[model samples]
Target: MGKSTASIDWLHRAPPVSGLERIEAYFSGFGYDPHRHDTYAIGHTLLGVQSFHYRGRKTHSLPGTTMVLHPDEVHDGWAGSDEGFKYRMIYVEPALIQQILGGKPLPFIHNGLSNDPWLYRACQVLVQRLDCGLDPLLEQDALFDLAHALNNAAGVNTSRKTFDYQAAERAREFIHGALTRTITLDEMAEHCGRDRWALSRDFRLLFGTSPYRYLTMRRLDLVRTLLGQGHSLVDAALTAGFTDQSHMTRQFRSTYGLPPSRWVRMLGRT
Candidate 1:
C-alpha cells in the first residue's frame, strides 16, 4: 500500500466549546500525518476500513466500530483497502471524557479500536450533531452509561463491586464551573473532599488524562465558543484564558489542521 499523509478535513459544526471541538467528516483516503492532538479523538468509523497505525500496531476500523486515540499519541491514517474509509469523529479534550469518567480510571481500549455494541450506541448521541444536545438528566444518564460502558470495554472491572462514585461526579462539576477559570488538583480535591493524590489517580483511571490537561480543555472549549460568536481571535483567546491569540492559534492549527482565521473563512464559504 502506498503511504499518504493528508490533513484532517473538519466540518466544525459543533456547539461552541472553549477547549475542544466536535468534528464531522467523511474521509475516503489517508487523512492525517504523524500528528498528535491535545484532545481525545473519539468517534465511530461509519464505513469501510479506516486504517491507522499507532503504538507499534496496525489497526483497522470497520463499520460500527469505535476508535479511541488517546491524547498526544503519535499516529497516522490511511485506507486499509481500495474502497477507502469514511468516519465521523468528535475532537473532545480528554478533560470532557475525564469529566464523564471522573476519578474512576481511564478506560483503555487496547489496539485503539472496539466493536462494542454499548459504546456504539452511546456514540449515537455524540454523532447526532450539536443540535441534539442531551437534556440535563438525559445527558447525565448517558454519561454515566458511557462511563460504565468504557470501563467494560477497557476491561477495568477489577473491583467488580460498588464504591463511592460521588467524588468523580463532584470533580467533574468543578471542572465545568471552572472552564474559564483556573483550577488546580489541590483545589479540585479540596472542593470534592478527597486527597489530592488520590483524586489525581482516580481521575486518570476514570477519564484517561491528567487534571491539568482537563482544565486546559475546558479553556479551549471556551475559545471555540467565543470564536463562533464572532469575537476576534485575540479577544477570544484572552477571554478563554489563553496567554494570547498566538497560543490559541498554535493549538487550533495543530488540532484542526488550520488556524482560527482560516477556519472561520472556510465556514463562511460553507
Candidate 2:
C-alpha cells in the first residue's frame, strides 16, 4: 500500500480475515485518543517515529522494532516528530492466541515494544503484506509462530493458576451465538456449565479480556461489516444489538479512538 502524503491522514485496510484486522495508516500529527479494544495490536513503524502513551507513559516506536499493545490497554497515538509516521498493524483476537497457547495467560511486553528479532520476523509476515490476503494455512502457521514468539519474548510465567479452559471456550462460543441479543452472566454460566464468577475469572485469564468486552467487540465487528455494506449508522447500530446510534457511536469512539463518521470517511479515502 502507498503511504499517504504528509498533508493528509489516510488508512488502508486489508481484506478481512476471521479473528484478524490489518491496516496500514499514516498520520501527520495526532492520531488517536486514549482508546482500546479487545485484541492485541501488533505491528511495526514503517516510517518516522510512531509515538503513543501506553501504561501511563509516552513511548516512541522507531523502525525495526515490534510494537505489541496488550488487549484492552488504554493507549493513544501520534507522530513523534514533525515529519509524520506511517505504520501497518494487525489486531489479533486473544481467543485466537488462546487456541495456540492452550489457555496460558496472554503474553505482555512490559513496555509495549519488543526488540526481539524473532518477534520482528513474526510480525513482518502478518503486516508486510496488508494489501494481499494470506492463505489460510500460511496465516495459521504465522499466527502459531507469533504466539510462541510473543510468549518467549515476554518470558515464562512462573506463577500458575488453575483455569477451566474448556468452560471458557464454551462460554466464548455461547457469546458468539448470542451476539444479536443481550446475554447475562448467569445465562452464559448455565450454558457453559461453570459458576458465573469462576467463568468470568477464567475467561479473563485465558482470553486477556472479560466476556462482556469480547461480546461488545464482536458486535462492533458486525457493525463495521454492516457499515461497509452501506448500512446507515442507526441501522448498523440497531442490527448489531446496540441500544441506539448514539450508544454505538460512543462505544465505537471509545474502542477505536475516532467517531464512526470519521472511520467511514477514512475507509472511503482508502
Candidate 3:
C-alpha cells in the first residue's frame, strides 16, 4: 500500500526536555535515511508501529515496546502502518551509557526491542517532560543501575579484566564537580593520578563512557536543576558553560529524549 509521510514539528509538538536529551517525536511513514549516529537511541513507540533494521535484520517495533539503537549502527526508520506512526526517542551517547555500564562493550540490540520490566522502569526513572536536580548520589546510582540493567537485558556476559573501579570513580567525581568551567585530560590525569589515555580507557571501561562525556552530562544535570528553579533557559545555558540555549537544548534532547520546555512542564506538574 502507498503511504504519506511528514516531519514531526519538533518546535511545536515535542515534549519538554529533561537533562541532556529526552523524547523526540516523528510521524509514521516518515523514514529517516539509513544513517549512523555517535550515540545511543532509546525510545518507545506511542501510536502505530515503528520499524527499522539493525545488525542485518528486518524488525518491527510496536507501542509499549522499547527500541534501542546502539552507537554507529547502520539503521533506517519508517512507519509500519498505513496511517503511519508517531513515537518519541532519546539519543544518548554510548559514552554516557558506557559510563553507566562501566566501560563494558556497548549494549547490543540484536533483538532491537525490549519489554523487560527492568528496561521499562529504567526509562521511567527519568522524569518525563520535566527536568530537576538529582539527589547527591542519585544520578550516580541511576547510571550504575541503567548500565547493569541494560547489560543484563542485552544478555552480555561480563568480562574479566584487571580494571581499577576506584580510580575511574574518582575521575568521574573530579569531572562532575567542575562542569561550570573548562576541563582537560591533563587535569583529570592529575586529579586521578593516571596518565591521560589510560585514564580515558579505564573511565570507559568502568563507566562505559568517556571522561569528557561524563562531564557534559554533569553540566546538563546542572542546567535542568537551574531551569527548574525559575532560571531562564538562556541564563541556565550560559551559566552551565554551554554555548547557548539552543546548543544545550540540542544536546539535552539527545540525552534525555525530549526538549527543555516539555521537560519543564512535566517538572511543573510534579
Candidate 4:
C-alpha cells in the first residue's frame, strides 16, 4: 500500500503571544503520552478523528466541536482512525481568564468537549489565525469574548466570590519580573501584603494553579525564547534559571508533551 498523508506526523507553532501558545499538528498514531499542564487547552479537530483520554475516559473530538481541557487535567492524544488526525490548539493561561472574570472559578466544559456555537466561534477566532501574531487590542477583544463564552458555556454563576484579586495580580506581576531568580511564597506574600497561607489559597482560587507552578512556567517561557534565538539547550536552561539542562528538559516534556528538541524540530518544518 502506498503511504498516506497521515503516514508522517508534523506540527507548526505560531509566534509566541503573552499568556497564550498556539499550534497546529497532525498525528498518525500515538501522540503525546499522559501529561498535564496549568493552562486551558482549547481548540478543534480540523480533519479526521482526534482522540484523547481525559478524566478517566476516552474522548473523541471531531470537526466543528471545541475541546476545552481545564488547567492541570491529565490527558493524552492519538489518532482515532487509520487516516490519522489534524487539529489546532490554543493554550491559554487561567490567570488571563481570572483577570477578565475578576477571580471567578475557571470554567470547565463537560467531558472536555463542546458544541456550543459561542465557544466554537470564540475558539475559531484565536486558533484559525496561526499565520501571524494578533494585534494587541484585537487580541484583548477576542480574549474578552472567549472568557465570557467559556463562563456561559460552563453555566457558572456570576456571583462574586471572596478572592483577593489585587493581591494575586500583584504576586503574578512579581513573578513575571523575578523569573530569573528564586521566588518564595513568603516573599510573594510580603510583596502583595497578604499572609502566606491566605495568598497561597487565593492564588489557587484566582489563578487556577499554585504560585510555584506559575513561576516555573514563566521560566520555561524564557527557555523557549532563548532556544529559538539559537542558544544551546544547556545555555537556555541556565539562562532560564533551571539547575541544569536535565531539569529543564523534564519540565518541558511534562508541560508541553514533547521535549524541547522535538518541539523545535517540529517548528522548523513546514
Candidate 5:
C-alpha cells in the first residue's frame, strides 16, 4: 500500500525570539487534549479544518480565518475532519499587551474566530513564515499593531471599576524581579503601595489575569527558556522557582496543555 494519509502528523517550533514563541503544525487525526495556556493563542488556519473547544463552545476555524484564544481560557485542539488541519500559532504574553496599552483591560474577542481585516493583517506579519523571524524593530511594530487591532476588534467593555495602571505595572515588575523567590499578595501590595485587595483587583482588571497566574506564567516562561538550553526538568523547575518538578509539571500541563516531554517533542527538541 502507498503511504497512509491518516498517519501524518508533525509539529515544528520556530526559533524562539524575544517576547514571542511560534509554531507551525499539521495533524491528520487527533491533536491535543483539553488544555489552556496563559498567553494569547493567536493564529490562522492554513488548510483543512482546525477545530477546538473554547469558552464552552465547539468552534470550527476554516482556512483564511483567524483564531484568537484568550489567556487562561480553557480550550482543546484537534482535527475537525479526517483530513486533519494545518495552522500556525503565536503564543504571546499579556504583559506585552500591557506594555502597549498601559493598563487597559486586555481585549477579548467574543468568539474564537474573526474575519476582522485589521486583525488579520496585523497577525499575518507575525505568522507569515517560520524560517525568517521578524527583526527587533519590526517585531515591536507588529506587536503594537496587533495590540491596537485587538483592542479595536474586541470593542469596549463598560461597567468595569476604575483601575490603577501604575500600581498594577509596579506589581508586575516586582513579580518579574522575584520569580525565583516566593511571591505574595501582601508583598505585592507593599511593592505597589496599594492595599492588598485593591492591588489584586487592579492587576486582574489591567492585565486580564490575577497576580498569581501572572507570576506562574512568568516562571513557566523561564522554565521554557532553561529547558531549551538543555536543562533537565528538575533543574528547570528548581531554577524557575517551583517547589519541585512535579509541581512545575502540573502547572506546565495546565498552562500549555502538555507535559514537558510532549512539549519537547512538539518543539522537535527530542
Candidate 6:
C-alpha cells in the first residue's frame, strides 16, 4: 500500500484551542492502530470511507456523517477501500465538554457515527478546516453548540443522577495548576472539599475519564507543546512529569495512535 507521505504536506497545522486540536489529513489505506485517548475524537470523513472498530463493531464513516468517539474508547482507523480516505478531526477534551454540560455524563453517540443534522452542523464549526482557528468567545460558543447537539442526538438522560459540577471543576482546575507535581486523589478531594471516593466518581462521571488519566493527559499536552518547541523527547518527557522518555512514549502512542517521532515527522517539522 502507498502511504501518502506526499499528502502530509497538504496537512494544515494549527495551534490547539482550549485543549482541542484540529487536523485534516488523507490516509492511503491503513491509518492508525487501535488506540484510546482521554478526549472525545469528534470528526467528519470528508472523502472515501473511514472505517474503524468502535463499540465492538466495525463502523464506516461517510461524508455528511459525524463521528464522535467517546473518551477512552478503543478504536482503529483505515480506509475502507483502496482509494483511501480524507477526514477532518477535532480532538476535544471532555473537561471542555463538561464545562458546557455542567456535570452531566458525557453524551454517547451509539456506534460512533451519527447522521443527525444538528450534530453535523455543530461539529462543522470546528472540523470545517484545519487552518480555521477559533477565537476564545467563538470557541466557547461552538463548544456549547456541540455539547447541546451531542446530548440531543444521543437522547441522553439528563435526570439520571446528581453530581457536583463545581467540585469536579475545582479538582480539574487544581490539576491544571499542579500538572508538574505528583497529584493524589486525597489531595484533590481535600482541595475540592469532597470525600475522596465521591470526588473520584464525580470526576469520572462529569469528565468522562478518570482523574489519573486526566492528569496524564494534561502532562502529555505539555509534552506535545514542548516537543513542538524543539525540545528533545527525553527532556520533554521528563519536564512533563513522566518518569522517563520510554514511559512517556508508551502513554503518548497509546493516546495518539502514533509514536512521538512519527507524529513530529507527519507534521513536517523534521
Model 6: lDDT equals 0.84
* Model 2 per-residue lDDT at 60: 96
TM-score of decoy 2: 0.96
Residue-level lDDT of model 1, residues 152-221, one tens digit each, is 7888556643333567567867887876666678888999899888877666555555676666656766
lDDT values of the candidates?
Answer: 0.67, 0.90, 0.66, 0.86, 0.84, 0.84
Minimal lDDT window, size 10, model 3: 4-13
Tens digit per residue, CA lDDT, model 2, 181-205: 8889999999989999999999998
TM-scores for every candidate against the unseen true structure:
0.69, 0.96, 0.58, 0.92, 0.91, 0.92
Candidate that scores best on lDDT: 2
Candidate 4 clash pair list: none
lDDT tens readout by residue for model 6, 77-179: 8889877888999888887777777767888887899989999999998886655557778877888999999999989575787678899999999999998
Top model number, TM-score: 2
lDDT for each residue of candidate 4 in 32-121, tens digit (9 for 90 to 100) = 767888889999899989888999899999999999998888898888888788999999998889889877878878799998999899
Please give the TM-score that candidate 6 achieves against the real structure. 0.92
Which sections of candidate 3 miss by over 4 Å?
A: 1-43, 51-59, 69-107, 115-149, 156-159, 224-233, 244-270
Better of 2 and 6 by TM-score: 2
- Candidate 2 lDDT score at position 11: 82
- Model 5, residue 145: what's the lDDT? 99
Residue 201 alpha-carbon offset, candidate 4, angstroms: 1.0
Candidate 5 C-alpha lDDT tens digits along 22-89: 88888776676677766898999998898888888889999877899988788877778767889999
Candidate 2, residue 42: how far the Cα is off, in Å: 0.2
As for TM-score, the candidate ahead, 1 or 5, is 5
In order of lDDT, best first, we have 2, 4, 6, 5, 1, 3
